[model samples]
Target: MCWINKIESIFNSTRCSEEDKVRFAVFMLKSNALYWWNVESVAQPNVLQTMSWEEFVIRFKTQFYPRTAVRQMEEDFLKMEQGNRSVRDYTEKFIEYSQFVEHYVSSESRKVKRYILGLKPSIREFVIAMDPATFSLAVNVVEVTERNKNRQGEEKVVEKRKWEGSSANFRSSASFRRPKFIKSDNYSSKQPPARTCPRCQQVQQETVNPNRKDVTDAERQVIYQGISLYLKGVFNAIHLIIFGRTTHN
Candidate 1:
């Protein structure tokens, strides 16, 4: 079928005569195709001389592209849908399949309708609403619609990622800026609290007498011992009052 189309394309471009078109196409045949053509020519010697390009195409398709295959191609074309294919890919397939089922897409309106029906629903709705009169216009509309839908999906994904990123950043920043209060077991270790002796109410004041210069060294030592004992008793009283225990003497 591709070879047939290529031959027709060359014929159309070069404006070749019918005889030249058939000859050139037969000349290009190779391997199995060449063998089949040789056998067909021997069976019908005058076929090439009498056959036009159109007649040659008919005979070639009858031999290689069987009726059953053509029918299956037509069925496939009728059942075609966009499925997971991109709009461009779907369009290319539609064009290829439509060639075998020309009766279905004989008119521009029918061709456009068939093409639109085969598109994915998301794109089909917009293309139908646009009501394109030409097959090309319909294809263009569907392509644009598909692109827009894809772009919107990508944008939604981007927005969701951005939102998640911002939420993560906000949580991190909040954790960083928030103050944490830690509880310590040794609260009084750094600076001891001031406590006064309950019995004294005031600290004891020690005085030195100038007249002590005439006193003996042993008498002065006895006075110092008495003051030290009194101060020790005062501390023990303070400790007992605060801690429920007396300091050892």
Candidate 2:
């Protein structure tokens, strides 16, 4: 198949005669190909001498390329879809496979319609609306559509990231500026003064009793003053520690 394509390219470029094309192709055949040609020539004597380039191609393909493979190729081409392939890749395969099914894409309109039908639904809808008259035009329209679709997807992603970033910043700022309790120096003054326990009063009465001879009056008075001062200091310290600020009144 590759050799035949090369020969066709040479003929197109050099404007070679049909006889010359056939002769060149036959000369290039080697090994098993050459052996096959020899056997063919024997089976049908002087067949090459009168054969045109087209006739020679048909005979060559009949010998090398089987009918079953050609039929399978045609069937696959008819059922071809873009699926996950990119527009350009699908287009290339479509062209390659179309060669085996010439009748399916014989006209430009037929080829364009077939190509459009095989495209992804999103692209196909727009292309059908445009109604391209040529196969090339249809391909161009779909390629542009695919590019625009991809660009839109990228923009949406960028926009989503920007929104998420701003939300994160807002959350962080709100946390940083949150209000906290303020300590005041006069907080203790708002509450009533601490009360002395009944037990302390009873002890004081016992210490100052007239019958008791453990201490003199002046010494009892001094001890009573000391106990009262100690209790006052303890209550004041507890209030200051718990409230963070306090005032003496």
TM-score of each: 0.67, 0.65
* Residue-wise C-alpha lDDT for candidate 1, range 59-114, written one tens digit per residue: 78788888898999999999999999998899999988887788999999999988
The segments of candidate 2 whose C-alpha lies over 4 angstroms from its true place after superposition are 1-3, 28-32, 175-249
Question: How much does candidate 2 score in TM-score?
Answer: 0.65
lDDT for each residue of candidate 2 in 1-249, tens digit (9 for 90 to 100): 556777788889989887788777788899888998889789978877877889888888787778898899888988899999999999999988776677899999999999999999999999999999999989999999999999999999999999999988988896767798664434323332344458764322233343356445555566688788999999999988877654433
Q: Please report the candidate that would top TM-score against the real structure.
A: 1
Q: Candidate 2: what lDDT?
A: 0.82
